[model samples]
Target: MQNQKTIITVTGYKGGVGKSTTAVHLGTFFGSRFRTLLVDADPNRTAVSWSKRGSLPFQVADERQAFKLINEAELVIIDTPARPDSDDLKELAKGCDLLILPTKPDIVSLEPMLEMVKDLGDANYRTLLTVVPPYPSKEGETLQKELSEGGIPVFKTMVRRTVGFERAAMAGVSVRDVDNRFKSAWDDYVSLGNEILELLNK
Candidate 1:
């Protein structure tokens, strides 16, 4: 059965593709507009750690704590363990309102996401290209075009590589709360959050 609450699951075949970061930012985005809850299911407990460091507008809990907190939440974002096998991938796809696959702009990151989509069946999902190299290099856009031409559903927003995210994490806040140099980085996610809202509404 589909979940009544709007749920998004972040996962990928490769690790360190910013899965937890995506989950955290997405949570903060929706949290301001709704009662959001971020569930940390990853073994690393990255999201859990982030919550402890700073003050977030929304509440965060581990997988176990999520059960009690979920019903009260209007939006729920799950940060799953990375490198899920095919079976787990299918299950994760089936369980959410949307499945987000975060990957860097490269063959290695792209390949796993491509493989996962092959098995999505009818799942509502989108690929987010992140940590894209900044200007003077169109690598991010180039990769996005190639993926779209190849028929993958990709978000228009590409998160540029920046250290602002790290500082925000250390301070337990969203990218917007960080340094001015990271403005573009935070804007990337703001654009991403808008795209997501549009997709779900449609």
Candidate 2:
């Protein structure tokens, strides 16, 4: 690992937004290329359980052990719980190279995400639109426009809502091991990882 370690925190105010899934898959993807550590900061321990059940090669750290892993790993991905406030977000935002907020296209999910963006108060962090439908829908387009006008940086590639993701999760496998239908999802995640790398390089 020649590059300096980069920290990425995945947060959202609402549950079922695919935060843990993103953390697991992204960690596995990057771990293949870099010495990555996945930190399960959420009290729920969903990521920790998933990794144990999936039997992944990556390591998981609790709050107490996270700093040590952060100091040692080439990359750290922190998976946070839902509904974290400004102060909480700030604490996690410190030393982070990138902050990824995953949200669905519906209004219920978008409102809190907007509040999170305001809380972050930094323009460099990236917002990822997750659980999007396969085809372009009216709601997805509208939400995309709202985010863009608000000056939030959102990735053009989106993760579609599919059973493949759920199935992979249950089996403790990543999208990388899933079928071809999810190839685009894997690519989108890789692209986001690449974007984070680019930002860190800058």
**Global fold similarity of model 1 (TM-score):** 0.95
lDDT (Cα, tens digit) per residue for candidate 2, span 99-196 = 88899988788888888888777635777888887675666666777788878887665667777778777777787777897787777778777776
Task: List runs of model 2 lying over 4 Å from the truth.
Answer: 1-3, 136-138
Which of the numbered candidates is closest to the native, going by highest lDDT?
1
lDDT of 1 at 201: 84
In Å, residue 107's CA in model 2 sits off its true spot by 0.1
* Count of backbone clashes, every candidate in sequence: 0, 0
Q: Which ten residues in a row have the lowest lDDT in candidate 1?
A: 1-10
lDDT score at residue 113, model 1, on the 0-100 scale:
81
- lDDT values for all models: 0.88, 0.79
Error of 1 at 145 (Å): 0.6
